[model samples]
Target: MRAAALKWVLWDVKDTLLKVRFSVGEQYCREAERMGLSLNPVAVNSAFRQAYKSYSSRYPNYGIGQGLNGHSWWTAVVKDTFSLCGVQDSALLQTLSNSLYHNFCNAQNWEVFNDSKKVLEGCSSLGLKLGVVSNFDNRLETILKSCDLLSHFSFLITSEQAGVAKPSLLIFEQALQKCGVSAAQVAHVGDHYINDYLSSRTLGIHGFLLDRDNKYDRSEVVPKGHRLNSLEELPSRLQQPMD
Candidate 1:
C-alpha cells in the first residue's frame, strides 16, 4: 500500500547531515603522530580498517549491546586497530585510544553539509516535525548542537539510548513514540541503502534515500520517487502526492 503523506522527517546523522574531515583511518594516523609513533600512515590506516571490520563483524554493536560505554567500546576498537600495526605498548595504546575517542567528540573533526541547515529550516517552516534516528551514541546530540542544528529537531534517539540500532523496528518506534506520529506519517532520510531506506520502508514509514553522491544503482526494489539527491529536494518531494 502507498504510505501516508509525510508529516514528520527523521534524519540520519553521520553521512546524511555531517561528514567527517577524513577517514577514521586518517584520524587514527594523526593521533599516532601526535603520540610520537613513527608509523606509515597508509599501512596504519589499512591495518586499522581490517581490525575495524573484524571487530564490528564479531560484536556487531561493538560491545555496546553488552553494556560497554561509548568511550570504552571505541577504546577497544582503537587498541585493536593499533595492535595490528604492531604497536604492543600498553600505555601508548591506551593513550592513543583515548585521543581518538576525544578527538571525534570535538565538532572541529566534522563538517556539516552546506545544504543541511537550509533543508532543516525548510522542513521546519513547512510545519513538519523533525527528529533524528541513528545508530550513533549520545555524542550525536552534542555534535548537532555544536553545528547549530539541534534546535531544528524535536528529539534525538540514539542506538545507545534505544538499546538497539537501525534496521531494528524498536529504534524507529521510539522516535515515533517521541514525536507522537504513526509510522505512516513519517519519512526517514539517510544515506545508507539498507539502514535508512529499506528499514523505514519495511515498517510502512516513507523512506527517502539521500543519495548525495549518486552512488546507488537503481533497482525496481527502490521506488524512483524515494531516491533524492539532496535534502533541498525534500520539500518539493514531500509536496508530491503519494500513490
Candidate 2:
C-alpha cells in the first residue's frame, strides 16, 4: 500500500527533461539559409506542425510497425515539411532532411532544464534508480549522451526500441521488465496527461504530470500532490504518498 518505497524514477525526455533551443521553424529556416535558400520561419514552422501531425497519424511511432525506421520516417516528415513550404526541389529536401536528422543527435540543439540535472542528482542521492521512458527513436541514447545526462540513467527504453509508443500500456510494461521492478516501485514523470500520466497511473505506477506553464488549473483537483509545477519539486514529492 505504501508503493514499494519508490525504487525507480522513470523520466520523459522532451519538455520534461530538456527542449530544443530553437523552434522547428527556426531550425528549418536556419538550415535553409545554410543551403542558400530563403524562407519565412513562420511559414516553415506552420508547415512542420502540419506535416508532423499528418505523418504521425498515418505512420505513428516512426512507422516501426510499417517497416520504416526512424531515419526514413523523419526524413519523410522533413522533406514534406519543406515541400509544403514550396521548396519543390527533391535533392535539396533530401539533403536538408539528412542534415536535420543527424544534427539533433548532439547536445548543441538542446537545452537541458536548469532543474533537470539537480533533480537527477537528488534522485540518485536518495538511493533511487533512474531511467528514461520516452517515445523517441534510437537517437535518444546519443542525444542524452551528447547532453552528458546519459550516465545518470541505468537504462533507456525508447518507443523505437519497445516497438510501441506511450498511451499504450505495452511500452510501460517493457520498462517495468527492464528495471526488474513492480509497477508500485516506480514513478513516471512526463508532460502529457494521456500518454504519460493516465497510462502509467493505469498500470499502478505513480504518474506525475508536469504542468510547467500552469496550463492545467490547480482548482481542477488536489493539484498540490497530483501534478508537478517543476522538476525541483520531485525529490520531495517522491517522499510523499501517491494519493
Candidate 3:
C-alpha cells in the first residue's frame, strides 16, 4: 500500500462539507408564514443578523460558558429575531423557535455540497483518515447522519463538546488527540479565515481555505495556493508536498 503524506484530514462542517439548505432568513420566513406570522424576508434577515450577533456576543459557543445549552441558546436567538420583527405572542414565539431549532437538525434544512462526498471518498481511498473538527453544537452528529455523511468521519468534535470554539487552539488539540496524530500529521480545512484556516495553521497543521463564493478572492490573508474554490481541488492538493 502506498503511504499517505498526511495521516488524517480534519474538516470544518458548516460551509465546508454541508450547510443549511436555505438562508436563515428564508427558512425563518417560511416557518413564520406557515405559523400565520406575516413577515418580510428582508426584515427577518436583518433582524436575524442582529439577534445572532447579540446572542453570540453575550453567550458564545452555544452559551456553554453561561451555563446554557444549545437548544436554549438557539431558541433564545430565534425568539429575539422574531421579536425584533414584532412577534409579541409568547405561544407563537415559542412554537416558531422550537420549530426552527429541530427543523435545522436534519436533511429538512441542510444539504451536502456537490463536491463534498466525492472529496471525502477520494481522501478515504488515499489511506488517509477523516474526521470533523467543527464549531457546531451537538446536533452536528444528527445533521451529518441525516445527510448520509456520518460514516465519512472517524470522529467528530464540536465546540459545545470541546468547551471551546475555533480560533482557540484547544479544540484542534482535542481533535489531534482523538485522532492519535500530531499537528504535522493532519491537515485542516474550512471556510472561515480565522476559525478554520489560521487557527489550525498556527498549531502547525496544514490549512486549506475553502472559498466557494469568492469571498476572499483579493484578500492578502488567504494565500493563492491555499485558497480553494472547490473541494475538487483537494485530492490534487493533498498529493503535493503541503508546505
Candidate 4:
C-alpha cells in the first residue's frame, strides 16, 4: 500500500544538526590541574556525556515529581560529575560549570553539522514545513540564527519555551500546533533512539533515526522507521511517502 507523504519535518537540534563542544570541560580540567587534582580529558568527557544523559532522562521526572527547575536539575548533575571525578573543591567546580553558559552562548563554540544547511535547504525547497523541537534554553534562537538556519524553520519550540523537553508529547504537540499539522502528518528526525524515535512514535508521529556515529548495527531490525547516517540523507528519505 502507498503511504502518506510527510508535510512537516520536525528536528532535534543538538547532536542532530549541531555539534556541541564542551568548553567547560577544558576549563574545568585546567582548574583541576591548578588545584593539584588529576583529571583526564577523556574521563571527564565520558563522565560529562553520561551525566548529560542521566540529567535529561531524570530532570523531566524531577520537574514533575519534586518541582525542581531545569537549571537546578542541570547544576546538580554538573556537581555530581565533578564530585565523582574526585575534584575536592566545590567552589572551583561550581565556577567551571557556570563557565559553560559562556560556551553555550557563544556561536564560535559550536559547529553546525556538515550537512545541516543542505538538508534544510532541500526540505524547504520541497515545501515541507520545518520546525525545531529541542531540549534547550532561551539561547536556541540565537544559536540557530548564528548558523543562518533559523529562517529555514517555521516553528522553533524549545524546552525553555514549551516547559517540557523532547520525549514529552507536549513539546512535539506545541511544534505541530505552530506548524498547523497533526502528529501523524509530521515526521521528526533526531539522533537519540529514545527521545527522537520512541517518543515521536508513541505520539503517532513518524520517526527518522540518524546514526551519525554508525554505532547502531544495521543488521539489527531498525524499529518501524527510516534510519540514516547523516542529514545529507534526509532529502531522499523525505522524498518517500510516510507510512
Candidate 5:
C-alpha cells in the first residue's frame, strides 16, 4: 500500500463545508413569525448577534458533560434572541426555540459548497485520513449525514463532545488524540483565521486558512501561502513543504 502523504486532515463544518442558504436574521424572522412573533429581519439579526454572544460568554460549558444538553443550550440562545427583539412571553420563546432548532436540523436549509465534496474526495484519494473538529453541537453528525458528507470523514469531533471550543488547545488536542497522530502529522482546514488557523498552528499542527470568499484582509495578519482561496486548491498546497 502507498504511504499516505499526510496522516490526517481535520475540517470545520459551518461556512467551511456547509452554509445556510439564507441569512441568520432571515431564518430567525421566518421562525419567529411561525411562533406568532412578527419581527424585523434587520432588528432580529442585530439582536441575535448580541444575544448569541452574551449567551455563549455566560455559558462556556454548554452542551457537553458540563451539564447542558443540546436543547437547553440552544433554547437559551433562541429565548435570548427573541427577548432582545422584544418578545418576552415564555410560551412564545419556548415554541420559537423548538421551531428554530428543528428547522435548522432539516437539510434543505443548508447547501454544501460546490467544491467541498470534490475536495474531500481528493484528500481521500491521497490516502489521508479525514476528521472534523468544530465548535458546533452533536447535531452536526446528522447534518453531515443528511448532506451526504459523513462518509468521507474517519471521525467527527465537536466542541460539545470535547467539552471546549476552538482556539482552545484542549479541543485541538482531543482531535490529535482521536487521530492517533502527532501534531506535525495533521492538518486542519477552516475559514476562521484565529479559531481555525492560528489555533491549530499554535499546537504544532499544520493549519490552512480556507478563505473562499476573499473577505479577509491578509495585510500583516497571515503569512503568505497559508491562505487558500478554495477547497480545490487544497491538494496542491498540502503537497508543498511546510514552513
Candidate 6:
C-alpha cells in the first residue's frame, strides 16, 4: 500500500466545513416582543450583518485609533444594530451581545457541511495530517467537537487563541509549525479570498478558495491557488499537483 505524500491539510470552519446559522437576531426579536419592540427578525438579522461588516472593515483603522480589540469592535456594532432596530433597553442589548458567546459555544443550530465529515474521513484514511485555522472566538474547539469533527484535526488554531486573525501570516505560520510541514507541502482551504487565498499565497503555501457565492466569477482576481465549490471536491483537488 502507498502512503499519502501530502504533509498537511488545513481547513477553515465557518462557511467552509460548517454552515453557521445566526440565530441571535431571532432570539433578540423574541425578547423584543416581550419588551414591545415589534421588529422583524429577518430585518434585524440583515441590519446586524451589514453593521458587522462595516465595523469589521473600519476596525483596523478606527478601532486601533480607539484602542479596541476585535471583541469590543463587534460588541459596539451589535449595540448599534440593536439601536437601529428600535431596541431601547441598554441592559437587554448588552445581554444580547453577551448571548453571542453562548450561542457560538453551544452552536446547537449550526450544522457541519454535508460532505465535511466524509471528506475528513477520506483524508484520514489517506494518512494526511489535518488541522484547522479559523477566525473565531474562543469557542471554536467546542463547536467542532459538538459536530464530532474535532478528532480529525491534529491541530486547531483560532484567531482568538492565536491573538491574530486570518489574512495574517502569523496564524498560518503557527498552523504550519504545529503540523511540522513546510509551506510547499501544505494546502490551506478556506471560503474567503482575502483571508484564505491571498494570505496563504503571501507565505508560499498552497491556497484553495471555496467560492460558494460565485462572487469571484466576474472578478479578475485570479487566485494563486485552486478554486473549489464544495468540500466534496477537495480530495480530487488535492490529488492534483500544484501548478
Top candidate by TM-score: 2
C-alpha TM-scores of all predictions:
0.93, 0.96, 0.94, 0.78, 0.91, 0.82
Q: Given candidate 2, what's the lDDT at residue 26?
A: 93
lDDT ranking from best candidate downward: 2, 3, 5, 1, 6, 4
Per-residue lDDT of 193-242 in model 5, one digit per residue for the tens? 98999999999888889888787877623556778888899888777776
Instruction: Judging by lDDT against the true structure, name the best candidate.
Output: 2
Model 6 agreement with the true structure over 150-197: per-residue lDDT tens digits: 999998888767777888899999998897867888888888989998
Q: Which residue runs does candidate 4 get wrong by more than 4 Å?
A: 1-5, 22-24, 30-39, 46-58, 61-67, 79-94, 219-225
Q: For candidate 1, write residues 98-217 as lDDT tens digits.
A: 887877877888999989999999988888989999988677888888778899998899887788888888888888888786787888899999899988888878889998877988
- lDDT (10s digit) by residue, model 2, range 189-212: 999888998898899888888999
**Could you report the Cα RMSD, in angstroms, for every candidate shown?**
2.0, 1.4, 2.5, 3.6, 2.8, 3.8
Residue 216, candidate 6: alpha-carbon lDDT: 77
Quote the RMSD, in angstroms, for model 6.
Answer: 3.8
- Candidate 1: the clashing residue pairs are none
lDDT string for model 4 (1-243, tens) is: 555567899999988988755555665576567656678877877777778778767766335345665456666767777877876677877765665544466677788887999899999888888899988866788888877889998878888767877778888878877877667778889988888877888888888888988877665315433788878888877787676
Q: Give RMSD (Å) of candidate 5 vs. truth.
A: 2.8
Q: What does the lDDT come to for candidate 4? A: 0.76
- How well is each residue in 1-243 modelled by candidate 3, as lDDT tens digits? 443358899999998998878888899999998997778889999999999999899999999988998899999999999999999899999999999999998797998999999999999999999999998889999999999999999999999999999999999999989888778889998999889989999988889999899887557444567788899998888888767
State which candidate, 5 or 6, has the greater TM-score: 5
Clashing pairs in 2: none
Clashes of 1: 0
Residue 86, model 3, lDDT: 92
Clashes of each: 0, 0, 0, 0, 0, 0
Off by over 4 Å in 2: 1-3, 219-223
